[model samples]
Target: MGTVYQINKGLNRPISFKGLKAQYIAYLSAGLVVLLLGFTVGYILGLPLVVLLPATGLLGGGLFVGVNFLSKRFGRYGLMKYLASRRVPVYLWFNSRKLFTQLKIGEGYGKK
Candidate 1:
């Protein structure tokens, strides 16, 4: 038999599943797990299957849709970048230029 090598088309690429990408896959999985636990807890607490079933189904549907939407809307790293950008202030508030004026070019910190 001749040697056959399988090619890895997804090498160095973000993990994707059924239209969800990267961290969004984790998000969807976590959400589903939470839903599953909630369903189990409710069922153990004597809640009606009628109520638990529909609630779990609706929340699971929402989780899938939301995660897929975020993956498409934000790409792989866009969501993280967007979240990081939100931490930045819109404008820097400076009362004086003393902080900038004290900087000596090419000088390391604490060097007199």
Candidate 2:
């Protein structure tokens, strides 16, 4: 007998795992990978296991906490929207009106 697994049928829903949603999962995974690489490099370079172990453990714990916090605070797409909002300028400082004036209905600049 073969085992059957239930598939997700939600339409356009963000992927989530263990309360971590969408990009937060990726963030946590990447952080863990970086910590693993750092630990490996430190070990190869002869750094004591005591130091590497504690440091890696602390970093991994921090990564999990931070990612979980972000996931909870900013729903699925809120984080991306927040980041995009930061890129918007507070005020537009146009030096001159020439740029706007040159724009005409159905015509290019300096063209008949």
Query: lDDT by residue for model 2 over 14-85, one digit each (tens)?
Result: 998999999899998889899999999999999999899999999889889999999999989999999987
lDDT per residue, candidate 1, 1-112, as tens digits? 9999956766798877788889998998899999999999999999999999999999999988888889999999999999987787868746789988897886677666
TM-score of 2: 0.77
| TM-score quality measure for candidate 1 | 0.75
Candidate 1 C-alpha RMSD relative to the actual structure: 5.6
Least accurate 10 contiguous residues by lDDT in model 2: 103-112
**Which prediction has the highest TM-score against the true structure?**
2
> Could you estimate the TM-score for every candidate?
0.75, 0.77
